[model samples]
Target chain A: MNDLRTKLMEAARSHSPSDAVPIGFEKQVMAQVLALKSTRQPGLLRAPVDAWALWTRTFLRATWSGLGVVMILSLGSLAVPPSDGDDSDYQGLMVDSIAMPIDETGGEIL
Target chain B: MSLLPEPSAVPSDLELVHAVRSGETERFEELICRYQARLFVMARRYARREDEVEDIVQEILLKAYTRLETWRGDAPFEHWLMRLGTRICYDFLRQHQRSREITSTELSGDEVDWMECQALPDGRADGKADAARTLVARVLDRLSPASRLVITLLELEDKSVKEVAALTGWSVPVIKVRAFRARLEMKRLIERLDREKYL
Candidate 1:
């Protein structure tokens, strides 16, 4: 069994080394290398976004979204009339105050 | 006293490495041209397809170029590049193993006959050599990537366990274990082939 194993291994090892490099393989490699070099951004300037950067970006995005929601809510409140039934008196008072004419002549004692 | 080396003398790999590190990027092409054939041959041992072989060679060259600074002048540049190449091959094998299953088809009668002929002492000729190489490749395809690599390095390339360890970043004991497993796997594969051929 050992001899057969050795013989098999010898047969396997006897397989000739393949030196048949495809034509233009070096040129292809050089082209790829050059392309990679050209496409590669400088490490310092274009390093991959780290955890800190990603966190900051996410935080900023969330903050901006929250601000947008707040702005929309504020604008929505301003556009819609107050729905509280108890504020009817205050609303009437506001209308009356706006309707009151401004005195154009010298102020008279009230 | 003459301060300069002879003009006719070839620059050593270390000298070229220094030139490359010193901003002589074009000189890298010289290194590439010098080592491309060797790297291709090494890649071929691990890669069955031509495209894969090219990819391995290209990757090795790109890595060696980008990491030139890491190469201390302790060993010959060729040896260093070879180590890098071997590691890349191992990685490729591992990746391939993960992505695919290894299945062995039974050898046909003609193929078995060819294998028998090649097994003879004097049957190694031009066409037969190619066939034998293919047969060996097919047999190797049935092994796990690690086993295949171990057998290829130990049996085919005649590398020692220590050498494989250094090349693969595996410990000596690990290499020994893998080699043993690889040999057993190979023996089983051969036995199966022998049965198919005779029965």
Candidate 2:
């Protein structure tokens, strides 16, 4: 096993790749690097809004949510029926009464 | 920026790194030229094709460039670069393993002959040496990526277990286990080849 291992190592060391870097390889790599640099926007330039923008964004978001709450409450109010306290009492009184005497001449319940 | 440093006044790796970090981007080319050959040699071990080797080297360089600011200049630049290169190689091996199935294909007549030659006393001849390398590559292809990497570092590169650990960031025990497993795997592969050749 040791002998085989040694032989394998020997073989590996002896073998070398035949491939060579093509001509102008460095030039090509540099060109690519330069192109990448040119296309990249500087971080400072890209970050135009800064802390002020963050503050504005947060304020706008808060305002929108507050406005949404108000709108929802208004809609809820519209969904409910309007009430007069006296009307409820009157309804209750009519429901409770079984019968009332009739005024014969006027044909009205008193 | 002032006039660029003259070629005669070649800067240290750390200085070059600092220059590149401080907006003197052109200095990066010097770093590339300085390490290109060594990086190419290291990359070739993992990549079978020329194009693949070149691609790996380019990727390594680009990564080094983008992460230059992270280097603390504590160790030699080459040492850090070597560790990075090994990591890249390991990743490539893992990806390759995932994408391809390991087939137990029969060795060709020439390959069988090469295997047989390795056992002979005079197998150190130039031609047989080449065949041996080809056989090693084929066998390595059959191994799991982890096993192949362990074997390459332990056996082929003659790295100590500690050194392998340092390069791979694996624990010493893990490196030892992987090395043992890799040797067994390689032995089985070679034995299978031998059996097939005889049959």
Q: Which candidate wins on DockQ?
A: 1
Candidate 2 Cα misplacement greater than 4 A, ranges: A16-19, A39-110, B1-8, B98-106, B118-127
lDDT of 2 by residue, B85-123 (tens): 899889989888742223335456566676677678875
Q: Model 1: runs farther than 4 Å from truth?
A: A1-4, A44-110, B1-8, B98-105, B114-130, B197-199
DockQ of predictions, in order shown: 0.16, 0.15
DockQ score of the complex predicted as candidate 2: 0.15
What local lDDT score does residue B188 receive in model 1, on the 0 to 100 scale?
Answer: 76
Q: What fraction of the true interface contacts does model 2 reproduce?
A: 0.26
Indicate the residue-level lDDT of B198 in model 2.
Answer: 67
After superposition on all C-alphas, the RMSD of every candidate to the true structure, in Å, is 13.1, 10.0
Task: Report the number of the highest-lDDT candidate.
Answer: 2
Which of the CAPRI classes, incorrect, acceptable, medium or high, describes model 2? incorrect
Over B70-113, each residue of candidate 1 has an lDDT whose tens digit, in order, gives: 78778889889999998898888878764222333455445566
